[model samples]
Target chain A: MTTLISVPLGEHAYRIAIGANIRRQLPALLAEYTPLTPKAPALIVSNPRIWRHYGTEVHEALTQAGWQVTPCLLPAGERYKTLRTVEKIYDAALRQRLERGSTLFALGGGVIGDMTGFAAATWLRGIAVVQMPTSLLAMVDAAIGGKTGVNHPQGKNLIGAFHQPRLVVIDPDVLVTLPPREFRAGMAEVIKYGVIWDAQLFDLLSQLPRLDRMAALPAEQLLQILERSCQAKVDVVSKDEREAGLRAILNYGHTIGHALESMGNYRLLNHGEAVAIGMIAAGELAVTLGYWSAEAAAAQRALILKAKLPTTIPAHFDVEGLLALLQHDKKVQAQKVRFILPTAIGHGEIFDQVPTELIRETLHRLQA
Target chain B: MTTLISVPLGEHAYRIAIGANIRRQLPALLAEYTPLTPKAPALIVSNPRIWRHYGTEVHEALTQAGWQVTPCLLPAGERYKTLRTVEKIYDAALRQRLERGSTLFALGGGVIGDMTGFAAATWLRGIAVVQMPTSLLAMVDAAIGGKTGVNHPQGKNLIGAFHQPRLVVIDPDVLVTLPPREFRAGMAEVIKYGVIWDAQLFDLLSQLPRLDRMAALPAEQLLQILERSCQAKVDVVSKDEREAGLRAILNYGHTIGHALESMGNYRLLNHGEAVAIGMIAAGELAVTLGYWSAEAAAAQRALILKAKLPTTIPAHFDVEGLLALLQHDKKVQAQKVRFILPTAIGHGEIFDQVPTELIRETLHRLQA
Candidate 1:
């Protein structure tokens, strides 16, 4: 069964198609929007890992649909997501003579989607990119928004643009291949939607048949998770595409989350794990500041625990170092980092003037 | 006296302040629009050559107005306009810790403006950019439009974006320092404006006391020339910000001009000189194709000759090489190179289906 979600983003509007084994419908879905000429070239950019699993199937499907498809594979890892890797993709695009009419198919996790979307954004000023997110983390968060960029040496997503995709294809069948830890990481964002905006999703996850692995969940339940998580993202992004105001709510736990990830040097903690820890810090901060009830905070913590995500800072982490890293976050404006603290179980608010001593105390407690 | 021309591009609307000695008004004009924080850093990206002449004036003005100004100097020349140079500006921006509120001031010729604008576009996703074009070509052409880019190794401006500027400042007094040859090259674009949109401007240029050197013309006439040329650009760009339709008329001679520049390896011929030669070729092609009159073509050549601009292809230039270079142009869609051909003295239309044989014959005649 196929479920379609439409992201009405004015001129950059596109559709998100979610289902099982829907990868075969890729060409038909793309042709519905793209006025592709016969034999118009399409470059499928993927990592060796994902490509090894699904490369032949996607290649044959596109070729059979009359696309002159070429597979451009890259090394699979967050460390490889840089401008240098993007340059390699540029070389491939040029070699294939990918014109303005050409489309790029990004088929992998967040790293592949980001690097491919960025390359597509810049190639010939801008071109069409179709996001085929293979990981649960990507399908829920990274692939929905048109925010495409490579991490600069100085910062994450500091060098990028808001170039929307023509289509976002999320296949639950691909989730079966995703690592278990990675799947749990994606649940952090799922719970984030629940804490920040949707109380019903919070209840939905609490009653899930199983939250740790893909196999433990029923097919209908998995589809519900994908649809709800993606719909939450599409709703936020469609309204605030540039993250000017309301979209900042989407980064509910990202202030401390990014800092934790940076402190861990991006290798120690995956984005989901860091966000999970960050949400705990933010929830405690809210409870201490009297914005949210302690009882509600405990309930939120239980959901995170049930999802099997981390809710604590590292033992060796330094309070001062974490605070300093927090200050350096790109969202810091006028010397104060904006923190998205919970007002209720299903609502969050942007607090610009979070007292430093309070954040320091929160981290100190987490250290204990 | 300052002459202000407003480019009403709705949300992207900005003012182009043009006149003698307007560089002194940079601070006041900028402060009017930019809600600059106290001591906000402004990186002035320019060639050392232009910096040497007016750098102190701009620096002191902004510094006195409480702006923390940093002069990031680059080597002066068209050959230096590449992504490598843009990276240098990014480094400087990063080193100076330029935030979203920080502005990049492009202070040189078209090469400096284009490269600086591109760097500003990509830095921190994008920041504010103020164009202070020191060359006539930049003032009339490159600076006004939001089209920012760097030349790729394969083709000119293949990698770029459409990022509009916060303001454009054109100081006519600075043209006194412009070389005589560079001044004549600027006239090619001025004449281009005449042929493509303004017949009255063509008559105005034809009646100039002297068209070769800035010193030879009256001060008022210089202001008139700058006003009329810039107004032409503002008029066209205001209507079509993104080159979807009417804006292609601005590429009246750029199709052939870019091919010639690339074929010459961007060294032997400056942009305007290549454009001057390109205009003549396009005019003749227009006449041969019966789209334009012979009298108009001859009049166009006479004006180009009067301006001391090139009207012929180089002696050693290969026709096939030029044809091959034309194919690599970014404007080529469906494998057909689109040309902006003249319909009258002050009107041009996009011609996408010009036969290859006609292009070859035109080049053959030019070779003779």
Candidate 2:
């Protein structure tokens, strides 16, 4: 069974088709929602690792659907997510003569999705991009939001555009190949949905015995996690496509998470791992500010621990450095860092006036 | 007197304020349409030549309006319209700690407007961009539309996004310093508006005793040209924000114009000069195809000549070379060149099946 979550962004709205092995249904799915000209050129952008596994399947599927398919593979990892990397995609796009009606398929994790979406966004001033997220992190968050961009040298995702994907195909079967560490990184976002928007999802995640690997959960549970997480993203993005207001809540742990990733040079911690630690810090800050109960914060930290995600900041990190990095975050307004703090286990709200001293104390306490 | 033309793109709609020395009124105009946070940072993007002339005036005006102003000056001309130049803008934006609320003011010709707008469109996933066109070409054409991008190594505007400006300020007074060749180049697009959408504008230009220089026309005539040209742009763009349909009509001469520009290596011929020659080719093609009459085509040629613009392709351009370049154009749809051919002086239509033979003959006949 397929769970289709429709993101209601009016004309830019698209559907998230979540199922096991649903990558095979891409042609039919696209035909229904975003029908293209027969044999229109489509570029499949992925890294070697993801491409080695599923590139042939997607390529053949698109070709069989009467679409001309070309492959553009790039180096895998968050480090390669830069404008220079996007230029490589542009070179491939130009070589393929990809037109305005053509589509670019993002066939990897968040990094690939971002670069591909951005290339598609700017190529010919805009083109169709279909998100085929292989990693759990991409499937649940990056692939659905239409927040496509590449990292600047000084910051992560500092340069980008709000170009939504035409369709997002999430196949859980592919997560079997996702490394355990990568799997856990995706769980951080899944846990985020539970804390910020869906308490039921949080409770369901808590009920699971282990979430460190895909094998730990039943097929039904994995589907539920993908569905609920994607739906939560759709709910927020559909309401605030440009992060004007409500969409900022989706950055529950991202403000500090991004700074930590940058501070670590994007190597010390994977995005999910950094986010996990950031969530712990935000939870503690909420409790310290009397916004959220200590019991709720404890439960949140315990859940992260169960997922084998980090709940403490690295001891080498200084509060002042992290605070300085926070000011550079894309969400900063008038020099105030906007943080999404949970008031309860299931609800979070945007706070632009979070006291820096409180954040410093929280970070100091969370040092590993 | 200031002439206002509103581009109605729903929420993205903005107004074009046209007058003499309207640069001084930018602060008040932005306050009426796009109110920013007090003392919000604004990056003024211009080339050294444009900056040396009017940069101080714009900077001081913005500074007095309570904007924290920073100037990012780049090399002038089309060759500098590349992603590398945009990177300079990104670096400057980063240096200023430009937030999502900050605005980028493009204070030069088409090159500056395009690069600045593209930078704003992608900076922090997009911010505000106000187009302060300092050239006649930019005022009547590039500044009015949201088509913003830098050229790819392969083609013009191959890498771009449709990012509308918050406000467009067109100051005719700035044209005093514009070189004669540059002024005539702008007449190409002005004649385009007359041919494609406004016959009245065409007749008005036809009646102008001399269409080559600013001094040749009265102040009222200049304002009329600016107002009518901007209104024609607004009329087409409001209906088609993206070049999905009616908007392509604006590319009347651009199909061949872009190809010719590419053939000249973007150095031999200015955009307006290439476009002037392209309009002649398109007019001849329309006549040959029986979609338009020879008399009407002659009238267009006469008007272009009156503006002292080129009416013939350079003798060195071969038909085969130009044809091959057309395939790489952003407007080519599914291996077919999409040409905007004139049906009459005031009306034009998109033609995707323009015969290569006819274009070959048209080029053959127009060789200088």
Candidate 3:
């Protein structure tokens, strides 16, 4: 039941392996991708919760396959995604004597993946990292792209690098362990893939009997969602690894989503949750600007609602604060926030000159 | 008379502009290399000492050329080169609203150039960094290479990135204002270029009447040293940008140099002074290992002495401490310290299995 999608990024090209029982394939896959060198150990970076579930099996698997493994536990959650977290990983890698030939295995969700990826990026300039994403959000989005970074107090992803992993291993079996809230939050990015590039995925998501829980979806549908969403991201990232251009569409909801996540102190809203709200705002802005049909916007909203995702700004959210944060968004060009506005159900375009007044008015209308 | 050496690194290609009174040409040179876009300000990262001397003139030139510039004053010294110093540059860049097209001008010595380059490499993933190296050390070596990083508590340059600058503007006039000890230190790297890459340059250096002070050298000779040394570095770096193989030769004296620099707490010996001592150690080790003739080693030592540089290990320096630091060096491949030993004045080769006993004996004999 292994499905492989190749992300063709020239020298950095890698494959995304997805399935239910693919966790067992780590040794074979790691060997195939990056062969183990003598005395070079693999450092597995995971949070306590995820490590508690899969650490022993993974350790045994790698050890049996002939790798000296060192496990590093990181505190779970977005709040712990900082330079301090990266420093600890550096300490572990150095302590374990992970050489340039060694690989770092990121074995949790997006937080673990980002932190570990950034550590790999700066450790001895650059080293190999293998992404073993356990969450849907990471498998289809975060771990697929070469983007790796940590948050600054001033903003999210303020410190980072573009270090691609040697391989990405996605295990759907791990998703069953994810909470319903987290599963639904991950759906936000899945839905974004539909709106930005695949209208068929958008339509398929709308017809699901249940979208809130992983248990409710058929295995076939889950595989399709993972493959198509990953394909959409791979299709984009392979063209532009460093976001020189054409990659702005991948950041469809991130400009507003990052502001929301930062304003909430990364506690009030998870990444996917904030992006869900951001997409709604962007959809509304698109409709108001006459670029998207009202029917398309309504259909998008219905799908997001069906997924049990938030579609409105937080009730007590401050418009001015959001706007201030938006100005600091990394997507800002010439001091103007670059918004990826929907032109149609399956397309989005970069609109850089969107007036602040337009944003203000939209935020005012969306606020409860 | 500006001498331009184009470092052809494919997409990252840039030119080194070397001449007297070239500080005035920064505005025009910057325009030629990376044009200043309206509303995107250039953030100048420099120390108080260098900034106090030439900051205003450079500021006026950029401002008069239609760039909105922001100046950030850093504490001057190698000890201040750390992640904390980079945080301030990020703050200032963010404060000034620097964007992707915006450039960060490093307007001091190697320390300033390295810090600014690292800040730019991480800020917004990366931005353009323009190297304006004031000191002789920075102009000839640090500023020419794409290596950017800061000292980690564990080691020097333990964390960093290979970020090439968009342009390098070298103003030799700044060396006139440089202190005598600092001038002597800068000559160490210049001397290294001669020992490792160019015999003609070595002979030219040996013919100098006085090498301790900047005023003692003829202006034509000074310009030749800067240009030839920079050209040698450019030839190496353009071929091997990330030190995969060939560029390791550029680290001729760095194996011991870094250990000396680190053991001294980066205070007792500055980068160039430590390198001067390390070169002497490396030369002696080469002779002991039968890789180089004693005549060549003595010639190397004579040039170092002619430049008024130290030719022996520091008195009371701990041999064990320095040896321990050498093992942790980034150049250590598979637990063996990779040494670049000279076979002739113009050539050096990478030798990996230099016996630790040989190093021990060399240190014991060279000790004051």
Candidate 4:
């Protein structure tokens, strides 16, 4: 099924299609920019793990469609998302003679999306980046919106630019190959949408069958869920694309989730898994802050539990180390910790200048 | 003479205010963001040259006005406009605890203006960069319209972001101590505005008194010329904010100018001087292409020659060496070279696919 998602960015709005067998048609979809130039190169950048799976298909598709394709394989890992890696992308693009009209395709997960996006954003002051998301994490979060950026060693998503992709091609069939744990990690964000803004969707998610054993999600069901989540995001980003106010709601569980990711060395736990546990802590805080009734908090707990994500940080992780990392998070403004707390099912409250005492107290309850 | 030079960016129209003692009043003007919090930290990035002159005054003005201040001194040189230098500003902002709503003041010439603007553009995804230009070269070109970015080793400004400054504060009195040679180089761009966009200004320039004793230019007359030149540039940049079409006209002489700067060790000559010579070559190309009448071309040459700028490359420079450098210029869209050529006085054309044979022929003439 081909589902078109249009992010309403005023005059710059374009369509993103999520479906199967879409990789074979990118050359035709991107034909507009090609004839605009006499020679438009296609530079495909991905990691070794992903390239081994889908690289040849991309090469064959673009080559067969009468396009000059240059493939560059980068080593996969979050640690490789640095200035050095971004430089390598530019080096390869330059070597391959990728001109201004040339299209850059980021053909992997979020790291590739971000690295390529940053490279494209800065190359000649900006270029067109076509996102081909090959992972559930990328399809659900990283692939959408114009927020393309890389993680700084100090914090995740620290050094980046808001360079929107010209196209985002998400093939749900690719999720079939994702490990069970990896797929579950991405579900954390999906659940976040239902908890903070869609009670009906939350109820539907609670009723869905076991996710671990599912092979291919029915096209219509997948499209409906993906479209709704994207619409929720689109509505918020359209209102506040730069994360000033409305967009911060998207960081519902990220305050503690980011810290947990850093404390665990970003390798031990995936982002969504950390956010799942962070949501539990937020639920408890919501009740303590008197914004959420126990029943509403329980409803949120049920979603995470049903999704089978971690309810808390791993037993070995350091709470103090995590706290230190949270201090450096970009979300912390005015030198005081900030939290996006769930007020109730389908609602959120951004609490700025929240005291460290409240945060520690919330974390203390999580220890239980 | 607080002339409000309008940067015509429809909704986000900013102004370049040229007057005396303007720097002292910066605090009172920014009531919008400062009231967000008390003791807002600001990072003041300056080069050794400007810091020696007005650094403490600017720093003290902010701090004494109840705003927190931090100073980072970078070495003064055009070569310092690199990613490495931009990183130093980033690291300093981080170290100084510069936060959201905290502003960055760039107090120097075009290099300082460009890098600081880029750092501000990408800091925390974006921030306010206030341009305080100390040189005449920066005042009319670099300080207006929000194009802040840094240079890549591969090419001049190959890697950068299009960030606009919140306010551009031009204190023309600061030029009292500018060296004679540096001042002459600045006139090249000043004259460029006359040649490429303002016929009336061009007529005014030709009728002006002797430029031989440039140091004797009264402050009032100097301010008037700078104001007109800057207004012309701001009008173009504000309309085509990203150099898409109208803004490319601003590169009227920068094609050969940038290549010459890189090939000349970036020390023997100033930027304005190289552009002066580059503008002459472009004038020759325009005439050869029959786009510019010989009388108009000679008139353009007279203005530059009056400022004592070279009409051809120095005998020591090699044609092939410059050609090798030109290939690295960021403006290349494909195998065809893109040169922003002047069609007539006060008129410019953007040729994205300039015939290479024409460029090589132009190169040979410059060598001759």
Candidate 5:
């Protein structure tokens, strides 16, 4: 029994379950909330490819378990995480007549989780949502926190609401079908935990066989990593449900990561891939500012490189475009482009008053 | 100096400044937060009528006090509280290059306050706002609460986020410009507080001269009424920040009130007037259920009539149209039209399971 962890957010606490092939346990999870002020119909939202593979089984499981399940298929892509897509989901919910008491089932990866959680948050003020994460990316990072939203053209997550989910079902078996590239993308966020909080987990990832050949993590290995990652997330959210101070730690690589994401036009590099590159940029600054020894910085760089992740920005990414994207980053998307840099290995500082001269020098380094 | 009462919601905790012309103190208020969080250029959201009256003085006040204030006048009507208007304000904010920390000044009434607060909430995820409520309804009710958003075409407040304003500056001086009928519309909500929490306030309202002429309330009278009203709203919001149970008491006459507002095309009877008539219908129900004596019901009717408020639904109103609109009331927009029927002279209960026959009986009384 790999135990379940709870993120205590005042009255919005939710449980995060970890285990192998826990997909079948979803029905039981839904049953757990049956006595919790019984909701209206449950709307299971996902993409077409996901629907083809696991939709029927999950739908049947929920139905046989006696839930009123209504499945809604959304177009799969980063582009679909917009107000336009939100409108479509809104239309479907209204057309299907899902009321305030209804439950939303977010049953896909990161994009689906964000858009669905936002939809749940905004429709008729708000509704209950249960996260059924299918990908490694969603399982470790996106699924736990109540930060749900879509991207604005100006910047990502520029329009969002803090709507907590009823429960989060993380079944490691779901990650088995992830492709090599996507599998490694998820590792970027996992590595973030090590860089900011756990030095031991950093060593663990440095020792893993290059993830290119591994389709899924071994159940035991997967459970340990997930439980630790979720525990870190729960600890942060518990202290600061609204992301005031302690929550900024979670955005260790996100400032540079978001800029890299927008620079790639939201397609070429996956989320974690961009963050991996961002971690490299932040590490360089850590070395330059004498916060970390050159040897430690080199070791951090070596581990990330060994993971088969690129440590440099792509050659074709426009520097000005990237800078503009950074300017639009919501953290300080205000008057200046602020960056969160590592003070030393296993520690970070959110710096907003840094001189623009240093910022330009770092951007120049990315000009491979 | 009447002491201001602060509602404690921690960081979102704010005080309701209930004095004569709290408007002149606006510059001092801006100074308090400017050193910590500088907001240079401001966007003042108001209606045309309000602009013609007090806009110059407000703009000059902020500008001379070392801030650039731009006024964005919205159409003055309840029907204008839709997403389209909100989107328009968002566009204006974007065009003005409003930064994340820039404050949106809600300057007209409840409709303006709700829409402006929502724009601030959604623009760049969230921004600060200060309520400069002009109407009696807004000063006592809408301006103080953190609830802010626009109405969806399907229903009122269907699309909104919980965005608390940084300040609420109540200037009873602005009431002098209000139309006779509009003034009474606000008193309906005032009476709401008295009926739900303080019967002493209710007795005081009955003693005030009929609300025919527009004038500044006596400084002492203004302080007490605004103070009591703020306390009533704050108590409800503090107990149930998310409108779970006790907060429902605040909607005493709003269920059928919304129906009446929609039936009259939002132009005929203002929100307060519809609520005025709705309270009478609830009073009739009190009579039906033995919760209200005939004397209490008549006294309530007499008080509203003295205020020159609407006591019955108009003859021109189609009963079916009223019922159809009732289907979209924010409280019961989805699950079969919830009503806050009066149980007694000093109390009411939120009834969600009431049958259609009772509604029809009440609608017929409105017709009669």
Candidate 6:
């Protein structure tokens, strides 16, 4: 069954299609939204591992649909997400002679989606990008939003653009190859959606027998996870396309999460794992500040632990270092670090007045 | 007195302030449109030469207006206008802790404006940018349009984004130190506005005693040149912000102009000189195809000569080589080289059916 969610962003609005084994339907799906010019050049940007497993199927689908396809593969990892790596995509695009009317298909996980989307955003001063996210994290979160970027040496996603994709194709079947750790990391963001915007989603996840890996969940439950998480994101992003206001709620765990990812040099913890720990810290802060109940915060931590995601900061992580990085965050305004804190299970709000001392105490409590 | 031209792009609308010695009014002008946060961080991205000339004045003006200013100087010239140089701006922005509320002030020629605007467009998914154009080309043309980008090795402006500046401050007084050749190069684009949009602008240049340097013209004539050229740009760009339709007319001489600029490796001929030759070649093609009058074509060439700009393709330039580069242009749609051809002195339209053989003939006949 195909579930379509529309992101109403005026002229920039697009639909997200979630289903099982829908990779072959890419061309037809894209044509429904944007008419495909026959024989027009399209570049498929993916990493080596994802490309090895799924590239041929997608390339064949587009080729059958009359797109002149070229595969550009990059080394797979968060470490490789930089402008230098994005330049490789630009090189392949130039070689393929991709023009304003051409499209770029980002056919991997979040890292690939971001770099490819950013390349599409800036190439010829903007072009079209179709997201075909392979990993769970990407399907539910990264691929749905128009946020595309690469990591700066100083921070994660410090350099980027808000270029929306023309279409997003999510296939749950691809999660068969995603590692268990990565699957758990994806759950971190899934849990984030529950805590910040969807109380029912949070309760549904709480009732699951297991949330650690793809094999443990039924096909129906998996589909629900993808649909609900994506719906929650669409609800927030559609109202605030550029994160001017309502969108900050989506960053519930990201403020501290991004700093943790950077402190670990993006090699130690994946984005979702860092977010998992970050949500724990934010939950504690919310509870301590009297904005949320201790019972709800405990329920949030229980859900995180059930997913087998990390809830405690690593022992080696320095509280002062994390604090320093927070000041450098893109969300910092007027020398104050802005954070998204949960006030209830189904809602979050922006808070810029959180005291440094209180945050320091929260980090101390969060440390393993 | 400042001549204000408003670019009516809805919420993204901004004004272009053109006047003599108006650099000091930047703070007041920007405040009228977008409220400035007190002590907000602002980075000045410029080249060494232009910095040596007017950087201190702009720095002081912004500082006096309560901006925490940091000057980031890059090496001067087109060769330095690449992703590598833009990285320096990113690094400086990071150092300054520039957040979403921060601003990047582009205070140089087109190269500086383009790079700084691209940096602003991508830095933290975009920040505010105020275009403080110090060169004639930038003052009348590049600074007004929000077309920010850096060139790829394969072509010019192959990598970029459509990021509009919050405000544009044009101080023609900065042109006092501009080299004679650079001033003439700026006139080429002014002449383009004539052929493509304003016939009176064309006649005004014809009536001028000389069309060479900044010092040659009275301050009143220079203000008119800046105002009319900018208005022509504002009229076209405000209608088509992304070059989806009517805006392609702005590329009248740019199709061949970009290829020649690339062939010269962006060194042998500056942008204006190459465009001067491109306009002549385009005019010849229009006359040959009966789309334009031969007398108008001759008059266009005569004006180019009057401005001391090149009307002939250099002897070393190869027609086939130039044709090859044309195929790689960003404007190439469905593998067709789209050209903006003139039907009269003040109007141009898109034509994708221009024969390659005709273009080759035009290029050969125009060779020095």
lDDT of 1 by residue, B238-350 (tens): 88887778998999888889988888888778799899888988998899899999999988888888888888899899999999988878777767899999999888899
Native contacts, share recovered per candidate: 0.43, 0.94, 0.56, 0.53, 0.36, 0.92
| Candidate 2 DockQ, CA atoms | 0.87
Per-residue lDDT of A1-368 in model 4, one digit per residue for the tens?
56777777765565677667777777776664223222667689998888878889888888887778788888888888887788888788777766677778899988899889888888777877888988777777887777776665565666678887877887776666667887788778888888887666676676776443236346566666666676667667778877778788888998899888887788777898889888888888878778889998787777787667888767677677777777777776767778888876777878886667777777766762
Writing each residue's lDDT as its tens digit, candidate 5 over B1-368 gives 42566777776777666667668777776565333143445699999999999888888888787776688989988779986787677767766767766889899888999999988877766778989899888888998878887776655677777778877888777888887777888888878877767777777767776643345345567667777787888888888777778888888888788888877667788888999888888778767766668887787777788778888778878887777777645465346777676655556677777677777788887874
When summed lDDT is taken over every stretch of 10 residues in candidate 6 chain B, the lowest stretch is: B31-40
Could you tell which candidate, 3 or 5, scores higher by lDDT?
3
Residue-level lDDT tens digits of model 3 in A245-333: 88889888888898898888777888888999899889888998999999999988888888898887888889999999998887888
Estimate, for each residue in B79-170, the C-alpha lDDT of model 3 and write its tens digit. Answer: 78888888999889878877878889999998999999988888888888999998888998889778898877676776788889989999
TM-score of each: 0.97, 0.98, 0.96, 0.94, 0.92, 0.98
lDDT of model 5 at position B330: 49
Flag clash pairs in model 4.
B146-B164, B196-B346
TM-score of model number 2:
0.98
How close is chain A of candidate 4 to the true chain A, as a TM-score?
A: 0.93
A4 Cα displacement, candidate 1 (Å): 2.0
Off by over 4 Å in 3: A35-38, A355-357, B35-38
TM-score for candidate 4, residues paired by index: 0.94
Give per-residue CA lDDT, model 2, range A20-62, as digits (tens): 8889988888888775554668789999999899999989988
TM-score of 1: 0.97
Q: Name model 5 segments beyond 4 Å from true.
A: A33-38, A96-99, A213-216, A318-325, A333-337, B1-3, B30-36, B39-42, B68-75, B89-102, B216-224, B316-330, B333-337, B352-355
Candidate 6 C-alpha lDDT tens digits along B1-368: 88888899998998888888888877888878665554678898888898888888888988887878999999988888899999999999988888888889999999999999999999989999989988899988899889999989877888999999988988888999999899999999999999989999989888888888888888898889889999999999999999999999999899999999989988899899989988998998899899999999888888888899998899999999999989878888888899988899988988989999999999999899
Residue by residue across B121-236, what tens digits does model 4's lDDT show? 77777777788898888888888877677766665676777777777888877887667777788889888898889887788778876443346666677777877888898778
After superposition, which runs of candidate 4 have C-alpha atoms over 4 Å from their true positions?
A: A32-38, A212-220, A315-325, A353-355, B32-39, B210-214, B320-328, B351-359
DockQ of predicted model 1: 0.58
Task: Please identify which of the two predictions, 1 or 4, would achieve the higher DockQ against the true structure.
Answer: 1
- For candidate 4, what is the lDDT? 0.77
